[model samples]
Target: MTNPTANDKWFQDRAVEQIHMDQLKRVELFNGRAAMLGIVIGILTEAITGSGIAHQIGLGALVDGYAACRTQFLPFCF
Candidate 1:
């Protein structure tokens, strides 16, 4: 027969583990969002900086910026 205290401790440990897992998931989600935001911000910064006065303002700047940001950001993923 399992001791009552042992069963309670097991349940408590499981609960704590679940909570930690949930917190980790939240952190992952937050990090993903932050990374996405960083990419977007980087792109916008590049585009704003690149928009020449003569041209009709194009998407090329944004794309280039995204590429640059990706290269810079990928290393952090590891």
Candidate 2:
């Protein structure tokens, strides 16, 4: 006969692995969404700020900041 305790342990391990996989999927989805939103916001900001050398510089900075924040803080939010 199979040991009930060993069977339960096996099932529990599989469940934990599944949960980790789901969390990873959610994180990837969130990252993609945040990246797209950042691009849109950067373009809009540049447009509203007006065309000039300053606008390009500002847009680059904004996009870089957004990427940094998304990488550093988004995991905690998720």
Candidate 3:
């Protein structure tokens, strides 16, 4: 598979510019990276507890109650 290569000079120039001229692109990039980190943390928590991310925090009871209420046809779950 042949992939097109980026212009080295342009890439270098953009990298240098970003160092001082932080733009929306930088914010978006950081947001995406933070989201990835959150997902990894969630996955690690699940692996350690063998439970969903919700239970990893403190919503396990609320979620379980809601689920039970829904299954048993109760009026209130929360």
Best by TM-score: 1
TM-score of each: 0.61, 0.56, 0.50
The reply for model 2, stretches above 4 Å from the true place, is 50-78
Cα lDDT computed for each candidate against the true fold: 0.71, 0.74, 0.78
lDDT tens digits by residue: candidate 3, 1-78 = 533355767788889988756777788899999999999999998998799888888666556866657676456655
Output the worst ten-in-a-row residue range by lDDT, candidate 1.
53-62
Over 1-78, each residue of candidate 1 has an lDDT whose tens digit, in order, gives: 889999999999999999999999999999999999977776776688765322234444334556546666334332
The best-first sequence of candidates by TM-score reads 1, 2, 3
lDDT of 2: 0.74
lDDT per residue (tens digit) for residues 1-78 in model 2: 999999999999999999999999999999999999977877787688765434466543334556646666334333
Report the poorest 10 consecutive residues by lDDT, candidate 3.
Answer: 1-10
